[model samples]
Target: MARHSFQSAMATQAGNGHVLGYTVWNHFFRPETDELHPMGITQLNRLVRRSWREPLQLYVETAHDLRFDPGAPADYAKDRDELDARRMQAISTYLSVVANRNDVNLFVHDPPRAGMSSDEAWRGDKDMVHGAPRGYLTAEAIAKGAISSEAPGGFPITLQPDLGGAGMAFPQPPNFGGDIPVGDFGGDFGGEFDVPPGF
Candidate 1:
């Protein structure tokens, strides 16, 4: 079932004009299987020691032989928090939804923030923090989607796109066909242009 779901997700993404290049989001983190599970470092230790080796090896080197993008996390961290959030969401979704796994254990295996004492072995594990980049969806795009300062009172919060990609030119109805003009939106077409010059 897991394999089928993964295949289906790939198919769906491909059907939507996306090229599936395994990169940063190639790995999946098998979160706690049991319900009402206890949380601890021990579980992480076990997962790192056991489940990760083969899966990661296959991801890093396959027929395609895709590799994780090694960039400065500081580069992404400097961007607006929203951008960071979107990146996290996309990566997480890719692993959990697309890869059919819960808990981003693979990505979360950060040794930098692990707070271990400064040592050669610990420093070597810094690569864990430098997560790989999934080709199409970068950290920037993901961060944008994560935030929603949704306007209160059931109002749609306009998407104020940040410094990077093009902000939406302007929102319109989903169908967006016909002569949907501004203000009246052509809804009341041929109607008198009222308002008395900004009364």
Candidate 2:
């Protein structure tokens, strides 16, 4: 699924001639499901190397923690912490190889903390993982500015111009022609799962 999504984004970049960036969430790798354990990282490395060969910029947000609910079990929290550490380590290793720290830039979300209650965190009304919308907004804005060269203070930026492009162009995803299915909603939706305009 990650590969497909990454390829799709690359294809979109190809068509639009815009830069590509990604935010890799820490929880995306489920220890129970072994999501992106080693193989996924390998594939991602290949994709990054391929994309790095392009003249465009590539931004990546490394694994970041957003506190999880333990539901009163201390052991569960401990296990989750351990699993998160391993995933972070794997990503760190991958970045060491693929990330040049310049054109292939790297950034991270704010460190996880008890900034909100478990209930609030679960609701994610403010942000995706924590109820801190301000921080998310600030981070997003800074990243956008840095990518567009319209703002400064995106630290750790070191200029290197000698780097050149190489590697194969990423392939586009296979098209399965059809409108996406939007499950049943009580309200009147347009035909074939299409949302009504101004919805």
How do the predictions measure up, each by TM-score? 0.18, 0.26
Full-model lDDT for every candidate: 0.34, 0.41
- Candidate 2 residue runs with Cα over 4 Å from true position: 1-21, 25-30, 33-35, 50-72, 97-199
Question: In order, how many clashes per candidate?
Answer: 9, 0
Across 122-142, the per-residue lDDT of candidate 2 in tens digits comes to 677524322111111234344
- lDDT per residue, candidate 1, 1-199, as tens digits? 9999999998886753321122222122222111111332233334435444344311111111122235755443334233334334544454455445464432211211223457856666643322222123234555667433332222223343434442321122221235644344433222222222212
Superposition error at 3 for model 1 (Å): 44
Q: What's the lDDT for residue 34 in model 1?
A: 15
Clashing pairs in 1: 24-132, 24-133, 82-143, 83-143, 86-142, 86-143, 87-142, 87-143, 181-185
Estimate candidate 1's alpha-carbon lDDT, on a 0 to 1 scale.
Answer: 0.34
Error of 2 at 87 (Å): 0.7
